[model samples]
Target: MSSSELVRVGIQIICEHLIEVLKEELKRSRKNYREDVDVGGLDPLEDPESYRNHLRMSENQFEELYEKVKSKIEKQNTIMREALPSRLKLQITLRYLATGDTYGTLEALYRVPRCSIGRFVPEVCKAIWEVLEEYIKVSRTNLLNNIYLVHSLT
Candidate 1:
């Protein structure tokens, strides 16, 4: 083979080796930094009273709400990692709403990254609102109708 051809082949091999080394380094870095905190195992249902205090609602109420909104908020797992469970998403959102805690506080408590918590909280809240909006509207309508009737009688 020509010297130029041999030199090109050598450069290509070096580039491939560097790429593999970079990939391995990335995997090692991710392993070192990833907080593999098992947030799933921390089930609030185990202590109902504490759960209620934390989220400002009973476990049964939380389950009912989860049933209604699960379809909207639940996500499928991807190859890189398992998706955060729908129940966890709801709990995080509720805790944030109940306590007005910052995402950093939540990250420490829940072992979720602050960025993930911030991204998912709004989405979970929207799902909850969508599920509950009909009940809210109906309740408001009934309240207004009762008020009008009482005013007319007076």
Candidate 2:
């Protein structure tokens, strides 16, 4: 081969090796930051009032909702990383709904990437709605009745 051809081949091999190394470094760094952060330290579930204020629901309510939707929203762990827990997924979704916080804010607070939060929020919300659609319709009817009764009394 010509010397120019040999040099080009050597550069291509080096570029391929560098890309592999960078991929490994990226994977290692990702594992270090997100999944390693101790979300349990926040422990919002430990305080019933705080949990209600933050998530707009009591712990019992959260648990009931979680139980109903867990099968749909729960993810399996994989070789690359552990899946976010079903309870955490529900909590995050509820917090988002309660606060209307941006995904960037949630990522900072929750130690989950905004991209993952964006992806999971819709999935969890769908699961919750699927599980609770009938309950919500009934609650709406009851609420309308209560409003009418109050107006009648006044």
State which candidate has the highest lDDT: 1
Where does candidate 1 clash, by residue pair? Answer: none
Model 2 scores worst on lDDT over the 10 consecutive residues at 145-154
Candidate with the greatest TM-score versus the true structure: 1
Candidate 1 — what's its lDDT?
0.77
My TM-score estimates for the predictions, one after another, are 0.66, 0.63
Alpha-carbon lDDT, every model:
0.77, 0.74
Residue-wise lDDT of candidate 1 within 26-69, one digit each (tens)? 77766654355477324665887888888899878988999999
- List the lowest-lDDT window of 10 residues for candidate 1: 145-154
